[model samples]
Target: MTPPDLAQRLAVRERPPGRPVMKQRWSRLLFLHWRVDPDLLRPLLPPGLHLDLHEGAAWLGVVPFRMERVRPVLLPAVPGLSWFLELNVRIYCHDDHGRPGVWFLSLDCNQPVAVELARNLFLLPYQHARMRYGGELAATRYHCMRHGEEAEAVYEYGPAPSAEVRNAEPGSLEFFLLERYLLFSQGRGGKLYSGQVNHTPYPWVPADCGKWSTLPVKWDGLPEPQGAPESALWVDHVDVHIFPLRRLE
Candidate 1:
C-alpha cells in the first residue's frame, strides 16, 4: 500500500460535502505518547489497517481531556449531559487505502449517555468510567477509573515553562501524531467504518506532566509501557466539528 502523502493528509482536513453532525469543544488536552514495538500492535488492529509509523516506529497515545459543548447540530448543550471528561488509549494507523487515522483500543468517559451514544452510533470502544478534573491553568489534575477496574489513572500536569506554543511542522513527528482527522472502528458483524472530525490545527507545547500513568494501555490488553513517555504535549483548547460515520467495508 502507498504511504499517505502530504496532499492526502491535507485532504482530510477539508470540510465534508454535507453539514456537520455535532459540535464540541475539547479543552485542556494532555497527550502522552510512547514508542511501541510494531509486532505487539499489529495483532490488535482490525482487518484492513496497518500501523502508521513515524521513522520506522509505532506510537501509542494516552490522552485525557475535558469535553464541553457536546451537542448535536442545531441543538443546545444539555447542562449535565454535555460536559464531561474522557481518556483514550489509541494508536496511529492507516487503512489499506493509505488514509491515516486513529484506532482506539479503549475510550473511558465519565458520561454514561455519551458512552452509549458513541458505542451505538459510531461503533467506538467507549466504556463508562468515574472521572474528575480540576485545578487552575498553571496546574491541573485528572483522574479516571473504568468500571470493574481496581486502579485509577491519575495525571498531574502543567505547562513546560520554557516551551513555546506552535503548530507542528508539516513533516515532523509532532504533525504526524497530532494532525490525525480520521478514525476507524469495527461495527456489527466486524464490518469496518470510518469517521472524520475537522478542527483547527492544534497548537501544542511540551507538558510538565510530572505525574502520568500507563494503566489505560495495560487495560487495553497491551504490554505495559516502561519508563517515562517519549513525548508529552499540551493543548489548551480547540473547537471541533464531528461528521457522520461512513462504511469502509
Candidate 2:
C-alpha cells in the first residue's frame, strides 16, 4: 500500500464532532526511542497495520508520564481515581488506509481500574503495576514493576540544555514519533479497532536521561536495546480528548 502523503498525515488536528468519550491530561512526559529493524517488528503487529518507518528504520518507544484529570466527557473527575503514572512500550504503525498510530505491546499503570477499563473497552494491553515518581522540575525519576510479572522500568530524566519547546518540523524523526493521532488495537477473534485522540501539537523539548533500563521492551519479546537511545524528548503537558473506539472494516 502506498503511504499517505506527509501533508495528509500531519493535517490531523481537528477534533471529532459530538462529545468525546473521555478527557485526560498528560504531563511531565519523557519519550525514549530506539531504532530497530523493521523486520523484527513486522511480525508483532496485528493485521492491516504495517510497520511505520522513518529514513528506512523502524523505531520503538518507552514513555513514562503522569495521567491526570481522567474522567468521562460529562462527568466529574474522581479525586484519587483520576490521577496515576503510566509507562508504555509502543511502536509506530500505519494501516492500509494510511492512518498513522501507536501499537502498544504493553501499557503499565498504577491504577488497576484504568487498566481494566482500557483492556476491556479499547482492547488495549493494559497491565497493573506498582509505580512511583519523584524529583523536581530540573530532574525527574520514575519507576514501575508490573503486577505478577518480573518486568519493570526505572529511569531519571530532565530537559536537555537549551531545550526549546516548539513544534517538530515536517519529515523529522521527532515529527514521526510525536505526531501520531490514532491508536490501533486488536480484540478477540482478531477484530481490529482504532481510537482517535485530539490534542494540540506537542511543545517538544530535547531531553537528557540517565539510569535507564530496557526491561519493558525485552519483556515484550524484542531484544534488549543496545547502547543509547536514538532520541530522548520531553513535553511538559497536553490536554487530550479521547474518542470512542471504532471497529475497522
Candidate 3:
C-alpha cells in the first residue's frame, strides 16, 4: 500500500479526462469532525482499506448539506426528485492503491428515489430519512431522522463572525478534511469500487456550530464522541461534476 503523501493528495484534484456522467450543486455545507483513535476505526473498514490519518489520528465527520440540480448528464433535473437534504456519517480512509477518499457509514437523504438510486446504482449506503433545512446562510438549521431511528440529528450553524472565506492550505488539518475528490464503496461479494468528483477547491470559513447532535455517529454503531467537534467548516455553494465508478484492480 502507498502512503497518502502530499503529492498523492494533490494529484486527485485534477479533472479526469472524458465526460462527466452527472452534475450537482451542493450548498450550505457544514462539516463537523472529531479526531478519534485510529484503532477504533480500523475494524469498521473493509479488508483493503486503511485509515487515512492526519497526525496519526483518524477523523470522523457528520456533514449536513443541501443538494440541488442533481441529475444525470443527459437528463434535465426533475423538480421534485432533483433537490433534497442529506446528512452523512463518514470516516477518512485510503485504499491499497493509496487513493484517499470518504467511506460513508450511512448517508441519510430525504428523497426515497434518491436513496434507491444511490444504493442500487452507485452502491453507496443511502438510508431514507425525514429531513428539513431552512434559514439563511448566516444562520441555518437542519434536522434529520433516519427511518427506524428514534433520535434525530439537528444542527444550527453559520459562518464564524468575521471569518474570511478561503481555500484550505496544503498540509493543514482543513485540507486533510475538505479536499477529498474520491469516494470508495463496497459492492457485492465484498469488492470495492471507487468514484471521482471534480469541483473547485471549497471556498470555506470557520463555522459557528451550535446545538449539533452526535446521534448520527452513534446510529452507525460507533462510540459517541465527547465534547464539541475539533473542526467545523462551512461553504455556501459548489458546482460538482461526478464521474462513473470503476472497479479497483
Candidate 4:
C-alpha cells in the first residue's frame, strides 16, 4: 500500500518565483493495516471476538476494513471498520530471486490517540520485534504489551474512533516514516497477526499536526459482502499500529 507518489504530492505544486513552498507534509506519524478473507475467517473467528476493550487505549479492536485505500493512508484507521480501512493483509514473502513480499495497508482517519502517541513515543532508531507466530487478531482481547519491554505496546481495534485523538501539542512528534507490513497466522492458535513497522524519519523534525499530519480517521463497519458467501465468510479483523517518533528539527 506504499504509494510512491504520496511524498511527491506533499510537495507544493504551485508557488511564486522564490517563495517558500508550503507542502502538505505528514505529522510525523506511522500507520499499519491488515486485510483478511471473510470465508477463511468465518470458521476461524471465535464466537467471542469481543471480550475486553481498553477504552483508554485507541481504536476499536474489531470493526470493518476498507480495501481501496493506500498504505500510508490506512496507518491509523481502525481495521474492519470501513471500505476505506479494510484491505487484504499481505505478508513479506521472498520469491526465488529474494524480492519483496505481498501485504495490505489501511488508512488512518479514525485513530487519533494512538496516532498521537506514536508521534510522541515512537522514537528514533525505529525498533522491530517478531514472534515468528503469535497472538489472536480475530478475537478482540487486550493485546499484551509484554511487561519489561519498553518497545512492546498493546494494540486494540474496534468500530468507534479513539477517545483522545486531538493533537494536544503540535510539533511534538517528528521523524522519518519507515513503514512496513507483514502478515502471519499463528500456527498454534490459527490467529492471524500483521506486523506494522515504522522508523524515525530523516533523523527528526517537529511539525504541527494541523498542517503536517492526517485528519482523524472515519469509522464505518463493513457492508454486507456483495460477491459471494465464501467471500463474506472468510474475512477476519486485523491488527495495526501508528508509529511516530521524535527528533530535533
Q: How much lDDT does each candidate structure score?
A: 0.92, 0.88, 0.92, 0.23
Instruction: Give a tens-digit lDDT track for model 2, residues 1-249.
Output: 666669757765567676789999999899999999889899999779988888789999999999999999989899999999999999999888888889999998999899999999999999889999999866899999988767567889888877677998978889999998889999889989999999999898988887677888876778989988989999989999999998887
lDDT of 4 at 155: 31
Give me the displacement of residue 164 in model 2, in angstroms: 1.3
As a TM-score, model 2 comes out at 0.96
Candidate 2's C-alpha lDDT?
0.88
* Pairs of residues clashing in candidate 2: none
For candidate 3, report its TM-score: 0.98
Deviation from native of the Cα of residue 160 in model 4, angstroms? 25
Model 2 ranges with Cα > 4 A deviation:
none
How far is 73's C-alpha from truth in model 4 (Å)?
A: 26
**Which of the two, 2 or 4, has more lDDT?**
2
Clash numbers, per candidate: 0, 0, 0, 51
Per-residue lDDT tens digits for candidate 4, residues 81-186, read 3222211222222122221212222223223333343233331111122111122333222221121233322233221222222221212211011122212222
Per-residue alpha-carbon lDDT of candidate 1 for residues 1-249, written as tens digits (9 for 90 to 100): 677888877787787878889999999999999999999888888788888888889999999999999999999999999999999999988898889999999999999999999999999999999999999876899999999999999999978887889998887989998999999999778899899999999989999998999999888887879999999999999999999999885
Q: Per lDDT, what order, best first?
A: 3, 1, 2, 4
Q: Candidate 3's residue-wise lDDT over 1-249, tens digit each?
A: 656999889999999888999999999999999999888998989998888989878899999999999999989999999999999999999888788999999999999999999998789999999999988878899999999998888899999999999999999999999999999999999999989999999999999998799998888888999999999999989999999998988
TM values, all candidates:
0.98, 0.96, 0.98, 0.18
Q: Positional deviation of 24 in candidate 1, in angstroms? A: 0.4
Give lDDT: candidate 3, residue 153.
85
Give the Å error, residue 67, model 4. Answer: 18
